[model samples]
Each structure stands twice: as C-alpha cells, then as structure tokens.
Target: MSWRTPADALRNELIELFLNHPTESLSGETISEHFHISRTAIWKHLEHLESLGFVFDAAPRRGYRLLSTPDILFEPLLQPHLSTHSLGRSVLYRPVIDSTNRWAMELAEHGAPHGTVASAKEQSAGKGRRGRMWASPEGGLWMTLVLTKPIPLSRAGELTLLAGVAAAQSLRTLTGLDIRIKWPNDLLLNGRKLCGILAEIRAEAETVHTAVLGIGLNLTVAREDVPALLQETMISLSPSTSSPWTKARVAGAILSALEPLYDSLCQDAAGFSGVRSEWIALCAHMQRTITVRLGEQVVTGTCVDIDERGTLTIEVEGKRVQVPSGEIVRTEVW
Candidate 1:
C-alpha cells in the first residue's frame, strides 16, 4: 500500500526537514508553525517517525534532534538524490512486500502513470528468470519501474537489454568496479552475479501496452542472509568496495540512468541497436563457449553476437543459431 494519509504525508515532510539538517534540532514550535499544525500534531508525527526506525532525542527547550535513521530506503531520503526527469517522479516505498514486480504490475493495471516506481526493503516472494526464487533479504535493493507508454511488443527483449546497460553503468559509477553485462539481463562484478533485471510486458496482439522493469541488486546483504546454495555463485557489492553503499543512492543512480534509455526506446524501436551493441561490449561471456537452456533443449556453442532485435547468436556445430529467449546455464572460457 502507498502512503496516502495526511498524517503519513506530514511525517514524511518532518523526516525531510530532519534529513536536511541532520545534526541540528528543530523545535516543536517551529515544526508546528511551519506546517500550520498544533504542537500535539507535531508530536504525533515525531512518534510515527520513531516507529519507522528513526531515533530522535527530545529536550525541554532545545527541541527534537535526529540521532539516527534506519538503513531502509525512505522516499524522503531518496528523492533529493534523484535528478531524473521521469523514472522516479512517483515512488511507492513499502518496507516489505511480496514482490516489487508483481506490485508494479498491479499498479500499472490500475492506471499508474509512466515512470512510477515501487521499491521494497525486503521481498518475501522475489523472482528471477525461469521462475527461480530470488533471495531478497533485508539490506538489498529490490525495485520495479513501470512504463505505461505504448511500444512495439517486438522490442520488449531490447528493453530488458537496455535495463542491463543502465544498471551496469550505475554500478560502475558508484563502486568503480569492472561491471559486466551477462547476456540478456544480469550484471556481474569480477565474475560474480551482482544484479539481475527482469522486464515483463503486457501487450495486445502486436502492440505493447505497459512494461514493468524489475531490478534486484545485491547491496550489503550479510553472508548468512543468503541461501547456502547460492553462496558460491551469488555475491553482494559491499565486499568489493572500500566505502559503504546506500540503497537510496544506488537506486537513484539506476533510475537516473534509465530515464534517457526508456525515452529512446519509446521514440523509436530501432534505437535499441545502440543498446544491443553496448550490451555486447559489456557482456562477460561474449565470444566464449556457453550452454543455453531453451525450454526442453539445451544448446552448447560459442557466444557469437546479439542481434539488433536482442536475439543471442551462437555458433553450434558449424552452424549459426539465433536464440530469442533462454537462460545461459554455464559459461566456459575455452
């Protein structure tokens, strides 16, 4: 559910004020006067802030001071960092949800505007490619961007590839890591999975009505928080960087990166050729031998190229094969 109540709005504004002046305190009288509300109402908002993991120290004459904030992504804390024209104009931040993609789909079905974003601190039913369960614990970034503008259904796969570029660029800028794109929608850092992007489109016949782009980024999840089976394969971004990472900042960076790409895709379907070329350059398994699982059949071949329409081209048994959709199960250098 979205924050719609008057009290919730007031609490968000109060948090924004405290974020602007983290070290300084704001008097109850000042807050009440600013919002044109009573001191009792101001106290109520402060109490709600504490419930959402905000700690404030109150004094008799000094006022209330923000001591600390939770690691979760709060909209007030995230908005100031975003400079995008569209992507995150309307954000729905839920502390926990079943899945950001599912929530975004529901919102789009109900006529949510383009560039609406849904984010969660934790997802109980996060999903990956091929219906695999994505381990989404706390301290990770789980977000979905909804695009309501109409585009061709044929370009849906290219949209996924575009999202990969946006995510890779954002990660590279923030962590200074050698980030690589893995095939259609995964991002890797130093040969380990760092982020995954899933683009789901709702279309009619040949026209696309809406597309939901979901991104699951492994930020600061603890080793114990991840499933034991994925420990060897999946990795987080925290261990590779010297500085700490904030979900809000990383999320803003991704949305900022996606705005222009999404605009390009909406303008023309052929615009994806640039995105496809960039994906090929950043792909980790490009020109390497890999196994792709396509439904019941698995194809083992050398990764050759990704076409303008986002199909993976592979050379199998001296023959060129185009795979429109599949999962790269394994990759071998030689």
Candidate 2:
C-alpha cells in the first residue's frame, strides 16, 4: 500500500517540463498555468521538491529557477527516466516498509506483470540470504524487481548473476569504486559488503511463476550509527567515496545502468556474452584458492571458474566441485 502526495505529481510534472526544456528556467507561474493550478499550489510543489533534496532558486519576477536537483527519491521524479518500456511500466515507492521484496511478492500473487518494481526507504524486517537480517536504513536503496520471463525454470538462476553485474556497474559509475562481485550475488568492495541480492520465487505446479529480486545497497549509515561489530562488518557507499551519495543518484544510476544488461539477458540467453564475462571480470577472487562454506560442511579447493548457470566451480583434489547459488557462500572476507 503506497500513497503519493498531490505535491509529488506536481513536482514530477515540473521536472518533466524542466528536463524537456533543459536550457530554460521554468517559471513557477508558468508551471502553475501549464498544470492548470494556482501559484500557491506551485509554491507547495516546489517546497515538496526541496524537501526531497532538489535545489531551485526563486525570485519575485522569475518565479522559480531549477538550479540543481538533489539525489533524493521521488518516484514520480524517476518515472520518466526509468527507460524500460515493459520493465518499469508499474512502480511503487514507499517511504517506509518492512521489505520491498515481500511487498512485490504479494503483488505478484495478485498477478503483477513482469518488471513491476517496488522500492522502500526503510525495511524493518529485511532478510538476506539464509535468513540473516539486512538492517535496511532510510537513506539506502531497497528495491525488488518482480520478473516473469519466458525462460525455462532451469534458466531462472541467471538472474542472480544479472543482478550482481548490474549493481557492480552502477557502483562503478556512481562512486567510481572498484567494486567487485563475489559468486552468487554478494557485492564486495575491498572485500566488504557494499550490496547484496536475494533471489526468490513463488511457483504454482511445474509452471514457473515469479522471481523477486531483492537488492539492498548500503548508502549512508555512518560508522558510529552502526553497531560496533557491524560497523566493521559492513561497508556503505559512504566509505569508498570522498563525499556522501544521495539515494536518488544511486538508485537512478542502478536502474539506468542495469536495465540494459537485464534487457540483454532476457533477449539473448545463449549469448550472455557480456553479463557472464563482466561478472567474472568484477569478481575479485575468481579462479583463486578459496574455501566454499555450505552450512556445516566446508570444502577447500582452488576456485576454478563459474559456469553459465552462475555456479561457482572449485577444483577439489582432482575434480571440479560445483556449488549452486542456494548452497555455498564465501566464508573468508578481507
């Protein structure tokens, strides 16, 4: 359940107008007239935009000048820039929620289409792989993309790798961090978690149903705010960058950058040429000696390679041992 303020709509309309007329300053009075609203209504809209971190200049004669837009999220503000026709045809944004993935799953059960997206500012009960809690704070990007592709059930596992590549590309673009992807969707930066992806599905009989791609990227929790051990355990966009990263910029970069990769994966299955190759390129410890931890059982082997199914292959003794997404995790982190 999400609600959008009237101010949100007005703000988006103004953003569309401004982006359309890039060089010209959009006057507040002109905006109101264009939207068939009042001057005071325009003021309220501008105030709301400011609250969302957009910067604008206002003068008595000129009305309002769109100077620079901040990186805070306003779904309507991001709607136009979503870029994908089928993917983001539907999107829901919530300022606070328990889990965007859970919400998206519920929507899927009710027959949401492919590429329907749900995002939240806070997740009180965010869950990572193996039921570990993901402490989702307000200033981070918490999103779930509900996907229903035509691929066979066996091919579904590729989404995890797809997500990792997308996230890595976005981080590289935004903060210029030399972020890497560990096997099975753990995003690593200097060997610390910068982002994580949890892929889930709901099926009815043998027919494939839905995939909830839950993604969480740590953005702005300073060290002092985090619990002592977690402060050392987790890393955010704040640590690697010289300055702070706003939610909007990070979110936009992720969607804009990743949408194409996702498009490619959906279009070309055998030719996962870029996605597979780039994922391997971003992995810090690819083909290196490392131990794969699968529950109580631990397997020590040389990291040989990753297969097309996104399985990590370990060279054990004389044979190659393959660990699937749901089974193994990297135990060692630097």
Candidate 3:
C-alpha cells in the first residue's frame, strides 16, 4: 500500500511545481490546464501545501510562487538529502521536550525499530556519561538515534567512538573549524568541550533489543549558563571565528553525515576501525597523559591507543594495560 493518499501526493506535487518552475508564478488556470484538473482542485492542493508549512505568494500578474520553506525536520527538508536506510527512517520532531533520549527509550520499549530518531529543540533533563546533568538549550542539536543490530554486547562501546567522529566531522563541515574528538565521545575545540555523545543500550539474553545514541552540542547558549565546574567543559565556535548556523541546519547536517558512517558499520568491522583511526588523529589527548577514574581506582597514565573495542590502553606502572571503562580526565583524579 502507498504510504500517501492521492491528495497528499497531489499536494506535494503542487508545491514542487511552484518551487521548481522557471517563471515566478503559474496561475491556477495554468496548473489546471497543464494537469488537466479543475481550477478548484489546483487551489485545494495549494491550501493543503500551506498547511504543511510552505509559503505561497499570490500576485495579480503571477498566480502563485513559492516563497519560503519550513526549516523544521519535515520530509521536504530532509528526505531530499537523506540517503541512509533504517538509521534515520523515522523522526520524532518537537519544538521542546523533556529529553529526546528519554522519549526515545520509551519508544524503543514499545517496538520502535532501528534507525528511529528523536529530535528536540531543547532538553530539560539531558545527561551524559556517569549520569552527569546535561544542559541542552535551544541552540544545539539534541538527538537520540535508536538501533538494534546483532552485535556482541562487548562491542557496544565502539559505537560511542563512532558517534564522536560523526559529530566532530559535522561541526567541521558546518563551521570550517578544526574540531577534535576528546577521549571517548567529547568533541573538543582547542581543549574545551564543544559536543558530547552518550550511548545507552539494552540487551536480552544474547541479543540486543535497543541502542540509543544521544548527541548534544552547544550551538548557541549563554556562556554564563555553563556551570563554573564545566567552564572548561563548554566551548563554542566564537562568533568572530565561526560562521553562524541555525540549529535546524545543524541537526540536518548531523543526520546527513551519520547515514554513511552507519552503513559502513553494517557492511564490515573494518569500517569501524577506519573511522577510529581518524578519530585518534583528531583526538585531543591521544599521546598525552590523562587520568582514568574507574570507580575508586584513579590511575594517571599516558594515553596510548584506543582499540577498535573502544577501550583505553594506558601505560601505568611500567605495564601496558587496557582500561575498559572509566571517566577519562585530563587532570589527576586522585
């Protein structure tokens, strides 16, 4: 069965006609004559297009011309650019929400399939690794992508690193800034945090049921709202140095860039490795010393390499050991 009704398809075609027509306006009579439909049908299609958030300019000389398009995550804006499947198939858009990730979790529980995306203008209770409160105001892109691939639970950590590369590359493309990935999933400008990714997963027996990938970047937020403790954790493309971009466009670019990377992941494990090397080259603390806060075990060591599994290989006590999980820190945690 077709996903659209005849009227829906007709309405979409009418909007495209005005948008793509060489002339400024095609009169209702002209469209009716061209499509062999009645003038009233043409007018009805225009009305339907208007309800879908399109700007139509009607003039005496020119019957109708498309003026502006909706900036929301509507299909008109995204479907033209989206090329990946399943990863971003469904989108839940909102002007405001408590948290995109929270809502995505609920949706996943109720059988939302892989590649479902929940996006919001702002998040009231956003968070990061270690349950740290995340402040997601209106200026940044807040999204949580859901997936249920059949990968080992132990391999789950790698996806966060994958998300970091996607976020960093998207920012670079949008602002022309040299963004870097910090250890794990922090996007860094110079040495401060510009964006973060939080990966949540739920497994059943030997299979995975849900994976939520949450991303938040400070696109436009008051510097004072950043907690004093997070002063070092918050960074943005300074107005003088960065080109201004709308939050909606930023969100669009993120999904656009993520689609291919996700496809590569599904094709082969080497795809994840290739992206990991690029991440290491762009990481802020690749060869430097940092502390890994693993519960009460605070060990300060030189950061060596992050394996494909996303574990940090640290040189501590003259022995090379891999720290599987911890809150990576640039300073001594002890």
Candidate 3 Cα misplacement greater than 4 A, ranges: 1-72, 111-113, 238-241, 331-334
**Which pairs clash inside model 2?**
none
Better of 1 and 3 by TM-score: 1
Residues 174-291, candidate 1, lDDT per residue (tens digit)? 8888899888788887777888898888999987888899999989877688889888777789878988878778888988887888788787745568777777878899999999
Clashing pairs in 1: none
TM-score of each: 0.92, 0.78, 0.77
lDDT tens digits, residues 1-334, model 3? 3322466446546655665784577887889987789988887777765765678888886688888875555433555556566656566666678877888887787777777777776788887878888887766678888776655565677778878887788778778888888777788786677888988888878555578889887766667776678775687665625566755566667777776766556554554577878888887777778888888988888888988777889898788878888877654311
Q: Which candidate comes out best when scored by lDDT?
A: 1
lDDT of each: 0.84, 0.72, 0.73
lDDT (Cα, tens digit) per residue for candidate 2, span 40-137 = 87777777667656677777776666778755455555665566666655566666788888888887777777777788767888878888778887
Report the lDDT of model 3 for residue 217: 77
Root mean square deviation (Cα) for candidate 3: 5.0
Residue runs of model 1 more than 4 Å from their true location after superposition: 1-8, 21-24, 36-38
